[model samples]
Target: MKRLLSALLATAVLAGASLTARAETVDITMAAGHPPVFRWVKHANQTFIPAVNKALEGSGITVNWSEQYGGSIAKVGGVLEAVEEGLAEVGLVSSLFEAAKLAPQNVTYFTPFVSSNATAISELMDRLHEENAELRKSWEENNLEYLGAAIGIDDYLLMTTFPVNSLDDLKGKKIGAPGPAVNWLKGTGAIGVSGNLTTYYNEISTGVYDGVIVFATAAVPGKLYEVAPYVTKVGFGAQYAGGIAANKEWFDAQPEALQNALRRGGVAQREAYHKDLDQAITASLEAIRANGGTVTEVSPEFRMKWAAGMENVAKAWAAQLDGEGKPGSSVLSAYMDAMRKDGATPVRDWDKE
Candidate 1:
């Protein structure tokens, strides 16, 4: 009877321990304004989520992800607010739309014709955020925490109904550009209309504009080539558009292991996203050619001339942010310095000018 009682008690203790070691299941709602068709959103769903899951194996923590995308929960300009309000725990917060709050992240947009290597640009921005507290401040101040993966756009190009062999071709033409990209047309003799990817196709087809400043990755998917058969590789440069981020309060409350796992996922996502992007850009350009679309690469002289003709929007942007006590000037200098250090020869040194 004594031995039986001891065995029974030991069994009960083991059962309690097993229950205590049971995995904790966390439900995390990940969101994005764009659909999974977009590379960034696709990688978030495919790469990031799986990386997190793999990292958490046998760690006594698991996540049940609730994915809301394609404006189901938040529109293009609303992801940041959604995460801030706790409507979603994590989101692909597009810095392009949140330029007012995330001014420094949009530094690449102001300094175009720099580098078209999306991977290098995205990794550089991630390194900057890791090393520079000033860049991270914008994310924190907005009640969010930026994860490592930077959603980068491929090189911006010119798509139009007519061929653009020279700057003279764009003279007096209506060109649609998104957000700060509109400034890219300054002194080019083209009228820049503020536009976006979602409406570019219909707007161009309906004669809302004759041309648009867009990227190849998006141009193929959006099928803008059908209407704008002439594609020009202007090399406006890859842009750091946004990143995967979590609500600050929620992220802060997570266990260190779980937090680290999410970060690992972000890093993995960045690699996968860029790999797919490189392939996509190639495939997109091929598709454009096969579909009767004309692709043109301007001469180096033409490119340089185009770059010189643009107004110094970077200086203006940096000055405005500096006036607001943000590290605008520093960010511009740091970004340009880093790009130069990485062997990128900008047609115009934005910070120096």
Candidate 2:
């Protein structure tokens, strides 16, 4: 009886040791600049993280997710810095807002009149990331690893109190724009107010600005329609990619299989994001109209006029980059070539072509 009890006790100890060995955990934190309700953050938390964990299931690895939305960790302008500093292991970065740091990659957003279709833009972005080694290196230099790109809502439109049927209608108006959009205000005679969708409502309400340059998906959730009530779709163009980025330091420390799982999860999340954006835009437009907002389709002639007026911004952007010794000219050229290849007839030379 003593011998049998000793054997059973030894077996129990071995079992406990094995269980402890298999219980390794990896905690990764992700952040987004928008509030929790914004589609980007909502989708990342609800759809992306879960898919990532599931992809790693049964691999003896577990992920602890920490999400910081509403600028809790990084505001829109500060995401890249936040990720690089290890404030969050992973984050949703806005290339548009980081043009100075991500000059070449972010230029895609400045190339107006490209296809407004999300799928095409998403595919183009994926191709760009694959084709441009330098572009990928840009992210790497910042101590971040690119996962996959997610498309923003369709082209920007003017949500204002006044109806803008033509370029002439915008003169002397106070237009709230984010980051690079300030340049968009140059030739139009409209006063440019730097603001984002998060503060758009308050800015408009407090008379800080008259209206905003924003997309529809955000309009509904932000309730901008309740205040401004006029959505003039300028068909400005589709916004190129923004996406999941992991701190390279943290990402490289993960096991190879786990890293692959995270990458696959990012691809899946991007696909889901595109799908959600389509539905969200439809719902947002409906919500806008329901709130007594006017949705008007700008005539092609008018759109052309608006596009023509903003022709100089590209050159200005390229020159600024050239001054910094970055590959501003080469990047801009590549993007324009790609745009034309994608059936876009840009109104002006984005890179003097």
Candidate 3:
């Protein structure tokens, strides 16, 4: 009896040790510049957080999430610094704003008229980052671990108070475009004002600009149609806006289980985000029409002419990166090549030019 009691006590102690070893709870903070109303931010909450939690199940690890969005923790173009400085453990870092730091990630923006499939662009970009050391280095240099969940914007549209049947219609017009995208207006005789979604509606409403280069998924929510009622589907091609990333230092210190969960969450989030975006694009256009906005699509010939007439921005962008000792030309070429390989016939081969 004494021997049996001693054995039972030893077994109890071992079980306690096992439980202690497996028990872990990690606290993480996720942030974004945009509010949860935005698709990217919405996915972070609905898709990413839940996916991470699901991945962590049965690992004896649970995550406590603190979400800070809508410029609560950081404003636009500041999310990278916020994560890097450890203000937030994770962030939706907008490469659109970090053009200088994340130059390589802006390949899609420079080469328009290639493809407008947001899901494909997101998948391609995520794969490129995984395959290219130079691309990965950009994030690493910024003290970030670039996860998946590439934030892709759908085909760009021109929203204006006036109609745009041809480039002539835009002459002398003050058009607002997001970063890097402003270059898209070059040679069109239109004045380009650098702006973002947060400012586009107000800017257009007050005559700060006549119209904006925006996407449908975002336009509906922004109620931009109310301000600029004409929507022209210019098909400037989908853009890889930004991505979800973690503070490298913080991420590196996490246990393997937690790290894997984060990565898996990123994958799930990317899939979910594009899925949501596809639906939103269709719904947004319908919403725009329902709310008294005019929707028009440019003729394919006009689209081709518009693309062809633009200055070789891709070449200049690549050259600028090359001067900076980054793989600008290679990335540009690789991106175009990948698009072509995937059966996309670009209106203009920006790289080849």
Per-residue alpha-carbon lDDT of model 1 for 1-353, expressed as tens digits?
99999999999999988765643778899999988878899988899999999999878898989999999999887899999989999999988888898999999999999999989999999999999999999999989999889987899999999999889999999999878899999989999998778789999999999999999999988898999999999888999998999999999988887899999999999999999998899899999999889999988998999999988999999999999999999999999999999999998999997
Error of 1 at 309 (Å): 0.9
What's the best-to-worst order under lDDT?
A: 3, 1, 2
| Cα lDDT over the full model 3 | 0.92
What number of backbone clashes does candidate 3 have, counting pairs of residues 3 or more apart or in separate chains? 0
Q: What's the residue-level lDDT of 148 in candidate 2?
A: 78
- Candidates in order have lDDT scores of 0.92, 0.79, 0.92
> For candidate 2, lDDT tens digit of each residue in 1-353?
99999999999999998875655677788888878787767878877888888888888788878889889999987888999999999898887778767777777566776667766677677678878887788789899898874555577778997777666677888999877767766677788887888789998888888888888988888889888998988776667647788999989988886788878877877788888888777788888888899999878887677777775777777778789777677778887778778887765656774
TM per candidate comes to 0.93, 0.89, 0.93
Better of 2 and 3 by lDDT: 3
lDDT of 2 at 326: 74
TM-score of model 1 (CA atoms): 0.93
- Model 2 poorest 10 in a row by lDDT: 344-353
lDDT of 1: 0.92
lDDT of 3 by residue, 27-118 (tens): 78999999888999999999999999999999889988999999999998899999999999999999999999999999998998899888
- Misplaced by over 4 Å in model 2 are 1-23, 345-349
Model 3 regions more than 4 Å off: 1-23
Which ranges in model 1 have alpha carbons more than 4 Å from their true place?
Answer: 1-23
